[model samples]
Every structure is written in C-alpha cells, then in structure tokens.
Target: MGLSSPTEIVATDKVEVAFKNLDAAILVGSMPRREGMERKDLLKANMAIFETQGTALEKYAKKAVKVLVVGNPANTNCLIAMKSAPSIPKENFSCLTRLDHNRARSQVAMRCNVPATHVKNVIIWGDHLSKQYPDVHHCKVNVSGGEVACFDAVKDEAWLKGDFITNKSWKIVEGLPIDDFSKAKMEATATELIDERDTAMEFLAKK
Candidate 1:
C-alpha cells in the first residue's frame, strides 16, 4: 500500500496543536549554524528550543512516542529534551548520530572500493560534534568471497579518522542531489528507532 502523505502542523511555543496522538516525533528545528560556527556554539540556543518543545511534548504527545533530535548540538539538545519531559523514557529520546554512522560506513566503502551497503558495524562514538570519533576498527566489509575488516582493507588510519570524518562532499553522492541530505539524515534517525524496536522485540521474545 502506498503511504499517506504526512499532515503538516505549524505551531508556536506549544506543540499541543500538532503533537496529539503522535506515535513518533522527529525534532529537527533549531538555530542553524553559520559558517565558522561550531556545534557547541549552538548549544544554548538549541537547548532553549528543545526545552520548550520537550515541555510541549510532555503535555501533548503520547507517553510512548519516540523522539529523535536532529538539530545542531544534537546530543546535548536531546539530553535537555529528555530531561524536560520526565514522563518519557530516556531511552525513547535519541540524538541523530546515525548520520555520522552512515558517513563512516560510506567512507569506509569508498576507501575499500566496495559498496556502502557492504560496510557494517561502523560506530560513531562520543558527542555529535567535530570531536566525535567514527571508529571502523570493528567494521567488516563484504569481499569477493568473505567478509574482512574494513580497517584492514583500507590501511590508512589518517584517511579513516581524519579525512573521512571531515570530507563529506555534500554536492554529489551517487548522483543524488545534496538537497536530499536533510531527508537522508531524518530517514537514518527513523531507521535507528526501527532497529531499536526490533532489538527490544527480540529481547522480549527471548525472555
């Protein structure tokens, strides 16, 4: 079945007008970073926005609603949102770290001359900032016959940690326009929640 188009709801200060009966909510609104501005620089402004939204979510959203914070300083913003909404489980709130994870996978695949889908287990650790580490030490890439460590396939630590982390050419990626990057990040965040749900189901089944 074809998916129904999402209804758009614009609200000011209060999300109650829009958040009613929400199953999932993705918070992507925040002050955009200007050139030369660091993610940390956005912390205060974004936290204020998140705090207000979080209160609104607590007032209007379903208690089980999952929230993904995609704004700048995402990690801290997510924490602020979660704290503001004490009714929601902390696990239900997450920052959009999947974008960094996907970037790490794509970079590993490019360096190894393999498809991005072939790369697995690339971990994005720490804050979602410049200091974030995309470690491929445990990642595996599908080879001609078997899986091999991505780090072993691409024996350049500098490229993996430095260039790969900094060089996300936002112009063209596999013929897709850079304008879709925002959508891609949102999709990645959604995918993370789906995976989380699946894991929870698996654990429950094993109990």
Candidate 2:
C-alpha cells in the first residue's frame, strides 16, 4: 500500500488503464508521506514509500484525474506524490480533509442535537490533523424552524491557524480490543457502498 509491489503495481496499472478510457483516475494511500528522513526514522520510512508510489503514478498513471492523500503527514505525502507525478496536474493533487470536516460537522450537529445535515458544511482546513482548522465559518443550517449559526463560534483566521498548529502531530489508534481492527475496519469500510442508491459513487464521497 505504501510503495511499489507486484500486485499493487499491477492493480495500479489496471486502474490507471481503466480510468484513462473513463477520462480520469484516482490514487489513494493509507499513510502519510513526509519531506525528510528523521532520527526516529518513522516519518522518513513512509515518505520513501509514498515517493516511490508517487513516481509510479506519475509514470504509469499519467491520465489520472486526481491524487488524494489521506495518509499521515498528509500534506507532505501529497507533496511527494505531486512531485513524483509531474505529468498529472498539480491542482488534481489534493489531500483529504473530509474525515476531519465530518468530525467537525458531526460534533457541532450533535452539540445542537441535530443530524449532521443540519450543520450544513463544515470545513477542515490547514494540515488535516488536529492542528487542522475545522472552520465552521461560512457554514449555515436549519434548526428548530429557524437558522442557527455556529460558524462564528470559531472566531477568526488566527484561531483556525492556531488550532491547526496546536494539534499537528502523529495520530495513532490504540486499545482497539483486537489486533485486526485496523485491517478489518479498512476492509469493511472499503467494501461498503458510500452511497447506498448510487453504487457507482465513491464509497466516501462528501456528496
């Protein structure tokens, strides 16, 4: 999943080739990619892997529509991927902040005791980590037959940037109660249709 492997490379090729006919392709990775190798070496390890895969996408998946990095060191990994895929438009390379945004929306909605839809749109900006600014600004919603605004709850740009900086760090899930939780969750989630009625839609599309 990190770098080039026979099966992964083959699958990547198949996807790229298939998508070329459809006019676009997407590449996703599970871990963050970073800029440098460090003393602890963990960050560098993922970066190396991402760099290699990015190169592969650049070379073989030239026609891809978008490259979305959801992995840790997301921004760095995105940068690495984009760097590798010179053929792909840089604007097509984006890191996923939807999950973080979802968290923000859900939290606010629950706080207001409403479904997430009522919160309208929640934007998670910055690095996509805790430091990420879950700017609820510009968000609107219908609640209790009236409009309730909470975006202003976050205040301003400084608060958002400060929030992002304050929370940027490695994320690790623990106490899963089982060793297989990671893979199991991923497999299960990946298999589920994101849009129940539209099976062709991305399993995690925001829409």
Candidate 3:
C-alpha cells in the first residue's frame, strides 16, 4: 500500500496557519480513551477536533485532497469531517479501515500458522470499532503445500461465527454471502453509525 507522508501536524487547532493547499490530509490526532471511558464517549470527544480539521481542509486544502482519519472512533469521526467539509467531495474522505483489514489478516494468518503476508481477502464490514465485522469466509492462506480457503484451515464453526476485531473496504470485495449472524452484526454497525451521524449533526448545530 502507498503510505502517506510522515509529516504529521499534531496541532489540529492550528490547521489554518500550519499549511495550505494540501494534497492529502492524514488526520491522526485523537484523544486517548482513558480508564472506564466508553466508545461513545471517545466518539463525542473527537468530534470537535475533526470538525475543525475538516473545516480547515475545505478552506485551505486542495479540492481533491484525500482525507484519512486514523484516530479511534474513525468511522464516525470521518463522517463528521466529511459533513463539515461541504466543498470536498464525500468520496475523498475515509477512515482507518486498514487496521481492521490488518487485524483480520493477522488472525487468519495465525490460524493458518503462516506469516501475515500469506493471508489475503479478509473483508472488514461496517464501522472501524466494536461494530466492525471481519469476514474471512472468502479469505485464503498460503500454506506449505498451496493456498486453501480460510474456513478449511480453521475448521471451527462456532469460532467462525464468534466476535472478533474490524473496517469497510467494500470496493475490492463484494457479492459474498452473509449469514444471519453476519447480517445482524452489519446492521448493528450501520445503526450505530446512523446514531452517531445524528448526534454529530446535533453537536454541529450547537456550534
């Protein structure tokens, strides 16, 4: 994957004066979740920070600048950022789905007893946090002899349907079968996103 620049600007509040005409903006700064903080709390805390950065991007960054939100609560934060920047095309915005992708990849790799590089095609569905679903049904691993379906390797039906860590890189993956359990998880993720969007709009209204 083509990685973004390491020149990170920690000063989210100073985006206006710090730079201009940016080609790609990797908004990685976020508040850490302290002891006993819920995911919703984390999401609410980062909303204002991303809102400011998104506004700055709209005013100063290039029209086609690709914005990647790498913080926790990334999906909701990305939504807030994208909504804040009306001029920037929505397709130009995204969140940290790579973590979900990599997490799924690692789990599959460990299951197959192969290096992570040997695993591919693990799909992360919906949000980037608790609501995310890592679908390995279509995944494959490069075993000693040859490649095999991830399910053939794991062979644990109950574990396959169990909870695991998550992203939504939906373009490269499509048309896969979704069982009832998977559907429920994906729907829950979507509902959570909708709630977050509504809350974000309300928060923005007060600003």
Candidate 4:
C-alpha cells in the first residue's frame, strides 16, 4: 500500500475556488508588516483576507481539518479566522508560533553549547509578535547523564528576556536577502518552518 494520487491544484485568489476537502490548511497569506507598523495596524487589513479564507474553509474543507495561520499579525488573524469559521471547532484553528518556539530553542542550544535538538519546552507566551515572551524558565536540555533545566544552564535572565527572545522571529525575516524579500519567498519560508514544526510534533506525538 501506497498513498493515493495527488489532489487537483486550484490556483485562485478567490478562497471559494481553492478551499475544498482539505485535511489540513496552512494560511501563509497576508499583508506584509511595513517598518513602524504595529500588529494592530494589520488587523483591519488582514481581517478580510482571513475572513474569506475562514468562510471558505468552513464550507468546503473537512470538518476535522486543522488550520495553522502563518500570516503577519498571526494571533489576531487566527482569532478572526476562527470567528469567521464558526462551524469548525475552535481547537482546529491555531496561529503558527513555532517559528518563535524554534528561535528560543536554537538560542538556548547555542548558549548551552549543545545541538538545537537537545533543547525542549522553550515556551512562547502571548502573541506571535515582538511583545511575545519566550520563557525558558521550565525548559530542559540534554546533558551528559540526562536533562537539566535550561534556566539552570544559562542564568542570564537579562539576555534571555531582552536580546534572545526579541531578536529572532520578525527581525530575521526583515534581514532576509533584499532580493528575496518578495511575498513568494516569505510565504515559502513560513511554509517550510510550519512543515518542519509539524513533522517534529508528529514525531513527538508518536513517541
């Protein structure tokens, strides 16, 4: 037994035309956040996009379909999508915060001089924006014998709360090669990160 053939590729800006029988939907489209723009500034601009997508997903996608919103101002965008898709279960919709999660993990690993894989439970709290908190207070990392608290390994609270957590997710995207700053490249990068995080989650679920 092999898996079935691929589904049809519907390329359309119209959400009604594209969403149909989807088992999982990853929303990576939204208006880009410009310099000096706050997350709330994007709320009105991106709300319509998520509303249309949400409505389409509600009507067309499988009832159990999982939705991961990767758009800018993701937390609020996800809230709009969820509200728009009232027919779908609330738990099925989530904002993609894994990029922040991975950033925290990598920073911890680098500080501890261990591979990123050795880090775990670097919790990301609040929104997916700059104000979000990446708390490693209860996180653990692999050691010679077993695992130990990440905070214990790196006691520099000022660095963790200030530079480590705040510098990565949004800034890294802004620092992408100027030529590669198009919508396509940014969407592709977000999609790749979502895929990687999903794979890791699936692996952990099985374990």
lDDT of each: 0.67, 0.52, 0.76, 0.69
RMSD per model, one decimal: 13.2, 16.4, 4.2, 14.1
What does the lDDT come to for candidate 1?
Answer: 0.67
User: lDDT of model 1 at residue 104?
Assistant: 79
TM-score of each: 0.68, 0.56, 0.83, 0.71
Model 4 segments beyond 4 Å from truth?
1-8, 36-40, 169-207
Candidate maximizing TM-score: 3
TM-score of 4: 0.71
- Ten-residue segment with the worst summed lDDT in candidate 2? 195-204
Which residue pairs of candidate 4 clash?
A: none
lDDT of 1 at 80: 71
Question: How far does residue 151 in candidate 3 sit from its true spot (Å)?
Answer: 0.7
Ranking by TM-score: 3, 4, 1, 2
After TM-score superposition, what is the CA distance of residue 127 in candidate 3 from its true location, in Å?
2.6
Residue-level lDDT of model 2, residues 73-118, one tens digit each, is: 4665666667666778788777766666777777666656778887
lDDT of 3 by residue, 38-83 (tens): 7567767888788888888889888998888888678778888898
For candidate 1, lDDT tens digit of each residue in 86-196? 998888888776777787788788788889999986656455544455656668899885899876788886676567756430111255222353345445545654443
Candidate 3 regions exceeding 4 Å error are 1-13, 38-40, 163-174
Off by over 4 Å in 2: 1-26, 32-40, 151-207
Which one wins on lDDT?
A: 3
Q: Whole-model lDDT, candidate 3?
A: 0.76
Better of 1 and 2 by lDDT: 1
Question: Per-residue alpha-carbon lDDT of model 4 for 1-207, expressed as tens digits?
Answer: 111237645466655556767788889988987799764445556776877788888898888988989986676677777877888999888787777888889989889898999998665655554446666766899976589988677777678656885666222123423332234433555564454344433433443
